[model samples]
Target: DAMVIQNPRYQVTQFGKPVTLSCSQTLNHNVMYWYQQKSSQAPKLLFHYYDKDFNNEADTPDNFQSRRPNTSFCFLDIRSPGLGDAAMYLCATSRGGTGLTSSYEQYFGPGTRLTVT
Candidate 1:
């Protein structure tokens, strides 16, 4: 059951408005990361939480925020999604347990395609 899932695969929001995206998993993994990917570009890390140790990517904008209320779920909130926020939001998960050699191999969800008009 190591799978990541995202809801509302597509979202349409007005410019300078707020939006929230959700993710959940049955993997029981302790590390969860959120990534933003623009058209044809590599997924860029927005932030990650390693068993409550939150790590934010330096380039992530203030408009982007995340929350991990529990081990199985996480959320991405955009305070004011601009036109530039139009892209794909990918949620990924990985194990944080010892002896897991491939803990870094992230498993991504189908992703939410956001369109900011």
Candidate 2:
């Protein structure tokens, strides 16, 4: 079965400090997405990647960065996180699969809850 994994289910970081979150997938997908959610608000897409090409939301902060080492791994780097940056970080993988039925579907990993202290 396809799977996406996120390390360190919970993360704590000091204000104005840098932190990195990791995500990996065995689904061999060509696309990955990183989202941030706070409170009851909907998840916001911070970054998107299609074969190493990055597309970011216009409102995404400069402090947020992402890296994809290969087809199976992606990383989210938070530079100088502030109190408002505390939220749930979600990762997902999708596309480039054989079947058209689930082609537009995304497989998500358990989110990493980030706490800013």
Residue 82 error, candidate 1, Å: 0.4
Point to the candidate with the largest TM-score: 1
RMSD of every prediction = 1.5, 2.0
> All models: lDDT?
0.91, 0.91
- In model 1, state the lDDT of residue 59: 91
Roughly what TM-score does model 2 have, to 2 decimal places?
Answer: 0.92
Q: Write candidate 1's Cα lDDT for 1-117 as tens digits.
A: 568999889999999888999999998888999999998899999999998888999999999999999999999999998888899999999886667454677889999999999
Backbone clashes (count) for model 2: 0
How far residue 6's Cα lies from its native spot in candidate 2, in Å, is 0.6
* TM-score list, all predictions: 0.93, 0.92
* Clashes (N, CA, C under 3 Å) per candidate: 0, 0
The sequence of per-residue lDDT tens digits that candidate 2 reaches over residues 1-117 is 779999879999999989999999998888999999899999889998998899899999999999998999999999999999999999998875466544868888999999999
